[model samples]
Target: MNKKTVKSFRPISWPTKGASAKTGKWRTMRPVIDKEKCIACRICYIYCPEATITPEIEIDYEYCKGCGVCAHECPKKAISMENEVH
Candidate 1:
């Protein structure tokens, strides 16, 4: 039988304890979308690092970290970062 050499450390099993935490709880600001101004280009959804922005332009605050990547990358200037009320 031929033997193969291992190249790098690739862990198979991973822990998911804190991986699904709702990061939006600590957000100082949140992205608010203006439906009227939005062009539905999906730029925000593409730029969102957390994958929180949906294709329909709806923001999933549950996992949103409020990094503002979506707002900054929006070409139509439809997404805005506002102070979180709570």
Candidate 2:
């Protein structure tokens, strides 16, 4: 009779939750922006590491993680992280 055993596998650098560090800080989903506050200054668009914010266009929620970075960066503070009205 013959028998075989399967070997267990594990990743060297396991990418778990919030694995990527943002400037020595860990981060997960991030925010886009609210065009109402955006005055074409392009501040958020310039500082965005992920290049998620749109230029002269409303936020593209498809890529936005809603981290509130853009809201904090806004010069006018026009952006805010508001939860669903419901």
Worst 10 residues of 1 by lDDT: 1-10
The lDDT leader among the candidates is 1
**In model 2, which regions exceed 4 Å deviation?**
1-37, 84-86
Off by over 4 Å in 1: 1-18
Q: What CA RMSD would you report for each candidate?
A: 6.2, 9.1
TM-score for each of the candidates: 0.76, 0.50
lDDT (Cα, 0-100) at 35 in candidate 1: 90
Put down candidate 1 lDDT per residue, 3-36, tens digits, no spaces. 2343347443335533656787978899999999
Each model's C-alpha lDDT? 0.82, 0.56
Candidate 2 structure, TM-score to reference: 0.50
- Among the numbered candidates, top TM-score falls to 1
